[model samples]
Target: MSSNVGTSDSASIYRRSRRQPLAITSAVIGTTLEWFDYSVYAAVAAWIATEFFPSENSHVSLLSALAVFGVGFFFRPLGALFFGHMGDRKGRKHALAATIILMGASSLLIAVAPNYTSVGLLAPVLLVVARCAQGFSAGGEFAGGAAFLIEGAPEKRRGTYGAIHYMAIIFGNLLGAAIVASLIAVLSGDQMKLWGWRIPFLIGACAALVGLFLRARSTDTPIMQQAIMAGEIPDSPISETFRDMWKLVLRGVGLVCGFTIVTYAYVNMQSYIPAVTGLSAGTAQWLYSLSLAVQIPLIGFFGFLSDKVGRKPLMLAGAVLLTVCPIPVFALVATGSTPLVLLALIIVSVSIAVYAGPFTAAITELMPRRTRYTALSVSYGLAAALFGGTAGYVVTWLRFYTASPNAPAIYAAIAAALTLITVISTPETVHRDISK
Candidate 1:
């Protein structure tokens, strides 16, 4: 009997080992779909306003569309609260699957949305509603997905696996960039602004369907299964998470502020720089995409290094560099030289990868198993809303307020300062077991 029991246990372990790669793949794919949907908004921001918010006053139309963009960021914290609780109480897989479904629906609606010419003010209103849905889904998706990846990975290999989470983001950006590049190549400038822009969002909606298919097969983590069997998981994980893991939540906010600034500088800033700094929009987009392509592999290298050294040293280095480099980086872009712009973007992109690489596992391991999702979701969601989501607006306002083109430097400096303060307070989670 003992021999038979040992054989069964061995088989089970072997089966689980085989599933790890698939789980990671699903996590990456799901995250890619979410970001593909989210990032497309920024990638096509200029064209999107022309389509949805067409009006006599170009500035009002653009601001309205961008405000809709910001609306998505604001609703994410609510999604985080709702789905984070569900992940802790129900299961991570279920929460992720549901969020992706909602994300797909929202993307589809944006794809088919009527223009302001056709529907009047209601057009922008509907756009906000769809974006909010996407935001809420996104709010919950990453924290749940990160928690799932951490729980699924082996303790010693957590950072490597966690790196795979950011790998998905790189893939998503690459795919979005590729789509934009392809569109730019084939379509006439007028065609692109009018209708070609809709193709990417349509593609995003379809990609979500593919992600859902992948996520359907993912198995629950052992930690979650054990909690279910023991009946130790809280019935109201949000309340319990708030009570027990608020410190981790604050740490998450600080760390995510760093990530958001990097994203804004590297990703969203490209869209606005053309109008504000007199750079060509196409030139700026090309630089942004090229920098991301270079940064993807660097993200993997930094993540791997974090596992060897620690998350704090790498993150702190990146934060300090961001503070120092923002002025030089933006000043170079303001020169309107393609080579200079590319150089500036690549410098900023590489620096951002340090935090992006290890943050998945680092954030997940901060809280106990029962409150992990809730704590992480609140921290990440709020930070993204306050810092990441508003980055474009803040920089634009700064420029408008000071009438100085180098306003992005001030934004980057603020983010770096916040991150520096938080780095001191956060615990090292690289060597810890998150699934427990």
Candidate 2:
């Protein structure tokens, strides 16, 4: 009878162990769906803006549209603080589920908003409001997902699990790009500008609902639950994170410089280039989507390598390569040849993935369990806003002033340099036990 009892208990434990992997998979998928929902707006901005904004000057319209893109970043830190606090104080599973709901609601709102033709200034205002809500919800989604997977996975496989989260991000980007590309392929320009542009957002909103449902079923990490039970959890996570781990936050900002620029180039600038630099929008969309699809496998490969080679070396190499490569890379893209542009995009994408693939593990490992969500959120949100969110605006503003196309490269170079500082300061985190 005792033997049977022990066997039953062991089976239960094995079942839980199995559940953890599925939970992490859900977490990754949830985050990807959420971010992909946010990103599709930027991917289809030029078309959406023309349809909705109806400005006489294309450059001014694109700039206004992209400015609205940055507007979301402004709210991210606030969302990070609010949701990060909830994650640390409540649980990762709960916070993530809530964020998905908020994200989905905002996306749905955007999909159904009226155009300027129907509502005048109210159209843009509503768009900003929806984006702000999304920014706030997304602020904590990635950080929570990172911390959850890191804490839940076995120590030896933390890098692999953590990499899944980033894989989801790249996957989301590809999904968004593919959705937009497919629409463009079928629709005429007038049709796309008028109505087809909203389809991706509608799809994203639906995906977010699926993610929310999956997140509802995910279990909380054992470490977090134990901390709560032991009363070791802080009453106020944001204050505690700031007081205890400001250094880590600074390092996060520095690290984000590299991460953000790479993401900006791949996601934001892919669409921006055609609008601003005279590249064909159709060709740019296809190449960007194609390059991203090819790069996804490479991200997984590099992420696995990060565990063996150590996160620091890969990050350092990414920083160095980005610092030197941005100017020449952007110059080549400006030439308007689809082949050359695709080649340059892929090269930069591969170089950036070396760091991005491991960043979730590296950054989350730096903060203690007590403050992991808040610390990661603050670090990622602020850095992303400063560098990544503002990339298109700053680059365009620079181009407008200097009448030079080289300005975006300069922005990329500066951002990469900040990442170099982060690599110097950040220690390797692979295999670190979060329970400590």
Flag clash pairs in model 1. Answer: none
lDDT of 1 by residue, 1-436 (tens): 9999999999999999898877887777768877776567777887778878776876556666677888898999999999998888888889988998998899999888887878888877888899999889988888888888888887766777778888788778777766876787789999887788789889988888887887898887889989888998898888887777787788789888966865765667657667666776666667778888887887788878888887778777777776677888878877877788889888888877776777777778877898888888899899989888777666655665577777778778777778877876777878776557
**Alpha carbon lDDT of each predicted model:** 0.80, 0.81
Error of 2 at 434 (Å): 0.9
lDDT for residue 9 in candidate 2, whole number 0-100: 100
After superposition, the stretches of candidate 1 with alpha carbons farther than 4 Å from their true spots are 1-10, 55-57, 277-279
Error of 1 at 135 (Å): 0.7
Model 2 bad stretches (over 4 Å): 1-13, 276-278
C-alpha RMSD for every candidate: 1.8, 1.9
What value of lDDT does candidate 1 attain over all alpha carbons?
Answer: 0.80
Per-residue CA lDDT of model 2 for 1-436, tens digit only, reads 9999999999988988888867877688767876577568777888767756787888778778888888888888998999899999999988898888888888888889999988998999999999898888878888999988988877766767777888888888888877887888899988987788888878878888777777787788889989988988888888888887898888888888766876776577656668656676667777877877777777677667888887888878878877887888788787877778888888787877777777778888888888889999998889777777778777767766677788878778877888888798777887677885
TM-score of each: 0.95, 0.95
